[model samples]
Target: MKICVFGTGAIGSHLAGRLAKGGAELSVIARGSQLAAIREKGITVRAPDGELHCMPRAAADPAELGPQDAVLVTTKQTALPSVAGTIAPLLGPDTSVAFVVNGIPWWYYDSEGGPNQGTRLPQVDPGDAMRKAVGIERTLGGVVWSACTVTEPGVVEVRSPTSRLILGEPDGTVSARAQAIADILKAGGLGAKAVPDIRTELWAKLIGNLSQGPLCVLSRQDMKTTLADPAVREAALRSLNESIAIAAGLGIKLEINAEDRFARSVNTAHKPSILQDLEAGRPMEVAAIFDLPLLLARQAGVETPTLDLCVALARQTAAAAGLYQA
Candidate 1:
């Protein structure tokens, strides 16, 4: 299979390296120093399991690489508008566009069968740009669980010992396309699975971000450090419960223990990506990761006092730092 990873940052670089190692014909859309490094030295992934180096085709322009069997969009939500502008060149009639990023996806309501079905989240998509560009039929949802960082340009460091990527179709079908992408990721040594109910997986992954992301951004610390305080940990629990409640209001039941999940991340040194963006002076992902969840909670009539406060403070911090507009 041929794959083009759009936005080869930390996670995307690691994934593209793995796919190349797994024997798929791979290419990447990249820019700036990272693109130059990948063109000169290829992409490198440093993980506990091993290290990998591979030179798939690298280009800043999507048209330089052409269409592929799949296009994995791993760019942050802040970059989605630009992605919408450039991604058209990377699609064929049968290309699968999997958004392997964080927080609630813009395609969340596309396949949901109910009153909320076909709803567009302007916070995430901003005037149906992605919906109009990618369309519903070729779209897929992806949730990934690897803690990764760019050690340098063209280099990705995988901090987690265990990593997994879950993919699913919008309509809850057991899709051959999802399975095929999962197979490539699994072959590259990540635990990959295709699920029928991806919204549940989305809620499950989202709980962790809701629990820690805003807190970390506020504290300017990693998960292990920021979650060290008893008060902080308790607040994290409240945030998780509220988010879980929001998911329940939306009819997605997540069966994870809130406290246990908090406990598990107490020793993780990974800084939330939103915090990374804030510290780097780049645009923070407040809209998708923090704001959208709160919006959905309001829509569901779920009360999230703790989330509301943290997100407000986090948004303020981002604005004061000049990294976030709203």
Candidate 2:
């Protein structure tokens, strides 16, 4: 398979390395110092399974890589506009674009049948740019569970012992393309799969983000460190319960225990990605990760007082940093 990974940051570089190791004809669209490093030394991932190093064609422009069978977009939500602007060159008629991202994706409503079924989230997409650029028919929703960070320009340090990437089509059908991507990733030693319900998977991952992300961002600490305080852990429980209620109201039942999930993270040293963005002074994902859920809660008529408070504070944090507006 000919694959291209756009925005080869921490997660992108790790996936690129895995795809290369899995025997795909891989290329990466990257920029700046990271691009230089990948072009020089390839991508090296220090994972729990083992150390993996694979070199792929690296370029700053999608046009240089040409069309690919699949394109994995792994940048933050804030970069979607620029990605849409440059993504056309790497898309072919049969290309599948998988957004391996966090939070509610821009294409969440494309084939989703419900009360809010064709509704557009301008907060996430902003003028339907991604819908136009990538086309909804070829879009695949994905969620990843990996604590990966770029220790160096081309080297990624994956702190998580287990990493998984889940992909599915918008209409909840099993897609061959998604399965193919999952197979290659699984072959490369990551837990990857294509499921019938990607939304459920998304919300399952989102509950953790809602429970831990804001608190970690505010405390400037890792998950284990921030949740160490009994009071903060209590607040996280409230947040998780509220998020579950919101998901339930949207007709997606997630069977997860809040305390159980929180307990599992008590010793984790991984900092939430939003905290990392805050520390890096890059644009934070306040809209997609924080704001959109609140909006959906209101739409679903779900009362999320705990989520509201935390998301508001987190939004202010981003605003104060000059990384987010509104």
Candidate 3:
């Protein structure tokens, strides 16, 4: 398979390395120092299983890479609008575009089949740019459980002991294309699975994000440190329960133990990405990660009191730092 990973950040670089290791024809769309380094030294991933290094074609423009069997978009939500505008060159008639991103994705409602079916999240998609650029037929939903960081240009450090990528079609069917990608990722030593219900998988991962992200942002600490306090741990558990309630109200019953989830979070020393964005002066994903979930909660008639307070404070912090507005 010829694969192009758009945005060679931490997750993108890791996926690109895996694809190259799996014997796929790989290329990456990157920029700045990262692009230069990938072009010069390839990509180095320090993972738990072992070290991986692979050199693939690297460029700043999508046109340089041309079309591919698949294009994995791993950029932050803030960059999606730009991606929509510039990604035409990477799409062929049969090409698949998987948005391996965080928070509620823009394609969440395309074939959802519910009260929210066909509803568009303008905050995430912004004028249906992605909907038009990458049609639903070519779209795949992705959720990743990799805690990664770009330690240096072209180098990524995977902090989690286990990393997995879950891919699925939007309309809740097992797809051959998604399975093919997952197989390649698995062949490269990363855990990958193609699921029937991507939304349930998304919410399963999102439960952890909801429990840790906002609190860590407000406390300015990593998950372990932020959740170390007994009181805060309890609050985190409450937040997790509330998030599960929201998911339940949306008709997805997540089989998660709030205590177990919070316990795992207390052991995770890595900082959530939203906090990382705030410290680096990048735009925090307030709208998608924090705000949209709350919107869904309201729509589902689920009250997220802890999330409400923590997200409000975190939003203010981001706004005060000029990283977010509204």
How many residue-pair clashes does candidate 3 contain? 0
Over 1-326, each residue of candidate 3 has an lDDT whose tens digit, in order, gives 99999999889998888888888899999999999999899999999999999999988888988989999999999999999999999999899999999999999988999988999899999999999999899999999999999999999999989999999999999999999999999999889999999999999988788768989998999998988898888888888899899899999979888777777888989999999999989888889888999999999899899989888988999999999986
Angstrom error of the Cα, residue 168, model 3: value is 0.3
lDDT of each: 0.90, 0.91, 0.91
Q: Write the residue-wise lDDT of candidate 2 on 29-56 in tens digits.
A: 9999999999999999999999999889
TM-score of each: 0.98, 0.99, 0.99
User: Candidates sorted by lDDT, descending order?
Assistant: 3, 2, 1
Q: After superposition, how far is residue 183 of candidate 2 from its true place, in Å?
A: 0.7
- lDDT-better candidate, 1 vs 2: 2
Q: What TM-score does prediction 3 earn?
A: 0.99
What is the per-residue lDDT of model 1 for residues 71-189, given as tens digits with 9 covering 90 to 100?
Answer: 99999988998999889988998999999988888999987996899888888898889888998899999998888899899899999898888999999997999999889888899
Residue pairs clashing in model 1 are none
Q: The CA-based lDDT of model 1 is what?
A: 0.90
Give RMSD to native, each candidate: 0.9, 0.8, 0.8
Regions of model 2 farther than 4 Å from truth: none
